[model samples]
Target: MTRKLEGQITIITGGARGIGRGIAKRLAADGAQVIIWDIRPEYFDSVAAGFEPIDTMAVDVADPESVATAAQTVLTTYGAPSIVVNNAGINGPVVPVTDYDFETWRRVIQVNLDSVFLVSRAFVPAMVEKSYGRIVTVASIAGKEGVPGIAAYASAKAGAIGFTKSLAKELVTSGVTVNAVAPVMVETELLEQMTAEHIAASKAKIPMQRLLGIEELAAVVAFAASPECSCTTGFVFDASGGRATY
Candidate 1:
C-alpha cells in the first residue's frame, strides 16, 4: 500500500525536539514534506541533520507577525501546508497560583495559548480557502484536570482544547478538521523541570507506570494529521498511559 501522507505538506511548530521532533520525523518518514518551525535557529542545523530531507525555519509562534511572516515564506516556498501541528509549548515555573510570578505566567500563556492563536490565524486562512486542512494541537491531561502548580501551563492547554473543539465545529462543513492530543507526563526535556518526587508521584498515578515514548506519541499524531482522519474532529486522542481516564 502507498504511504498515507505521500506528497502532503506539513508544518510543525516546535519541531526541533521532543514530541514535535518525533512528529516531524514520523510524518517525513511517511512521505510528507515536513517543515519544522522552531524559535531556536541554532538547533535547526542539528535538527535538520537528524531529518535529512525535511525543511526548517525560525518561527516565534507567540508573535503574530513572526507567525504570519513564516507562513508566507512557507507558502511562497512550498505552497500552503495541508497539515499543521501546533505542538509548541512550555511548562511554566512550578508554583501555586498565589505564589506564581506574573511574568512567568504571562510567558507560559503566551507561548502555550497565544501561539496557537497566532499560528492558526496566520495559516488557517489558506486552508479555509482550499476547503481542506488538518490541525492537531498538542494538549495535556493536565488540561482536562487541574494540577497543582503550573497553573498557566494547564490553563493554556485547556484553552487550546476548547479552541480546537470550537474551530472544528465551525469548519465541519468545510473539509477542515481540528483536534487535540492530550498526553500524560512523557519522558521529554520538559520533564526535567519537575522535581524527582513529583515525577515519581506522577508516574505512580498511571496504571501503566511508565512514561510514553516519542515514537508512541508520534503514531497518534500521524493518524490525526493524515487524510485517513476524515471522520474524527474536535476529539482528544489520549496517550496518558491510563493516567487520564476521561
Candidate 2:
C-alpha cells in the first residue's frame, strides 16, 4: 500500500505523550519524517525507538526563542517541513474566570495560543518558500462553546481557532493549507491529571458519554495534514462525539 505522506516532513509539538504522541505515531506510520517536541527528554528513548530514526527535541513551545531554536534545529536536520501539527497545549486550573489565578491563565494562553503563533512565525516562511505546506492545530470544543470552569483553556483554544482561520486566509494563495481540529474530550493522560469531579463533569456534558480514543482523533489530524486537503482551509473540524451542535 502506498503511504499518504510519503516524502513529507512533519513536526508535532507536545509530542512526548498523549494526543501529540498519538499524532506523531500516526504520521510516522503514514510515512512522514516526524519530529517530536516536548519538555520531557526522558520519554524520547522509548518513543524514538518505535519509529525510523525518530527525532526528538525538548522545547517549551510558549517561548518564542525556544520555538525558534527548535525549529532551526529541525530544519537543519530534516529540511523545511511540509506538514506541522501545532498540538502542544496545557489544561490550566479548573476555576471560573473571576476565581482563576491570573498567572495560571497567562500560562495557559501562552502555551495553547502563543505557541501556535511562535511555531507558525518560525516555520511558515519556509513553507511559503517551498510553495507547499499543511498546518493542523489541535483545538478543543471549549473553543466553540464556553466551558464552565476551564476559562483559561477555553479562551486559549478559542484563540487557536481564530489564529488558524487568520493564517489560513493569509496562506490561501500559496499551496499551503491551515486548519484546526477541535476534539471534545479524549482519554489521555492529561485528563487523568484533572480532578475526578472535573473529569466526571466533563464526561457528563458529552453526548457520547465517553471520552474519545486517541486513534479516532488522529484520523482527523491525518486528514487535515493530507495533500488532498486542497479546498478546506480556515475551517474547524469538530470531533466532539455529538457535543458540538453548532
Candidate 3:
C-alpha cells in the first residue's frame, strides 16, 4: 500500500494514552516518523514500544520553556515536523460555575487553549519557512454547545476551535493546513474525571446515543494531517455521531 505520509515527520502531543495515543498509532502506521510529546515520561517506553519507530519526549505543552526546549530537541533529532497534532488536553473536574475552582479553571485553559498557541508559536515558524505543514487540533463538541458543569473545559475547547480557524487563515497561503476535529465524548481516561451524572448527561445529548471511539476520531485526525487535505483549512470536522445538526 502506498503511504500517504511516507517519510513524513509527525508530532503528537499527549501520545502516551487515550485519544492522543490513538492518533499516534494511526499516524505511525501510515508511515510517518511519529514523535510523541507527553508530560509523563514513565509511560513513554511502553506506549512508544507499541508503535513501530515511534519516539516519546517529556513535554509540558502548556509551559513555554518546556515547549521551546522540547521543540528544539525534536528539531535537532527529527528535523521539522510535517504533521503536527495538538492533542494534549484535560477535561477538568465537573462542577457548577459557582463552585468551580479557580486554579483548576486556569490549569484547564493552560493545557487546552494556551498550549495550542504555544505549540504553534514554537514550531509553526519552521513550517512556514519550509512552506509546508499539516496542523490538526483536538477540539470537543462541548465547545460547540456549552455543557453546564464543565465551563472551563468547554471554554478552552471553543478557544481551540477559534485558534485553529485564525491560524489556518494565517497559513492559508503558506502551504500549511490547520484544522480541528471536534468529537463528542470519546471513551478515554479523561472521561473518568467527570462525575457519573455528568457523563450520563453528556451521552443523552449525543444523537448517536453513545460515546465516540478513539480510533474513529483518529481516522479524522489522520485525514486532516495528510497532504491530501490540501484545499481545506479553518474547518471543523465534526465527529459527533449525529448530534452536530449545524
Best by lDDT: 3
Over 1-246, each residue of candidate 2 has an lDDT whose tens digit, in order, gives 778998798988888888887888788888888888888845755534466426778899999888889899888888889999999999988777789888888999999999999998788999999999999999999999978899889999999999999999999999999999999888987876688988888789888889889989999999999988888999999998898887
Task: Please list all clashing residue pairs in model 3, or write none if there are none.
Answer: none
The parts of candidate 2 lying over 4 Å away from their true place are 45-49
Task: Quote model 1's TM-score.
Answer: 0.95
* Model 1: lDDT to the true structure: 0.87
| Candidate 3 weakest lDDT stretch, 10 residues | 44-53
As for lDDT, the candidate ahead, 1 or 2, is: 2
Which residue runs does candidate 1 get wrong by more than 4 Å?
Answer: 45-50
In model 1, what is the error at residue 106, expressed in angstroms?
0.6
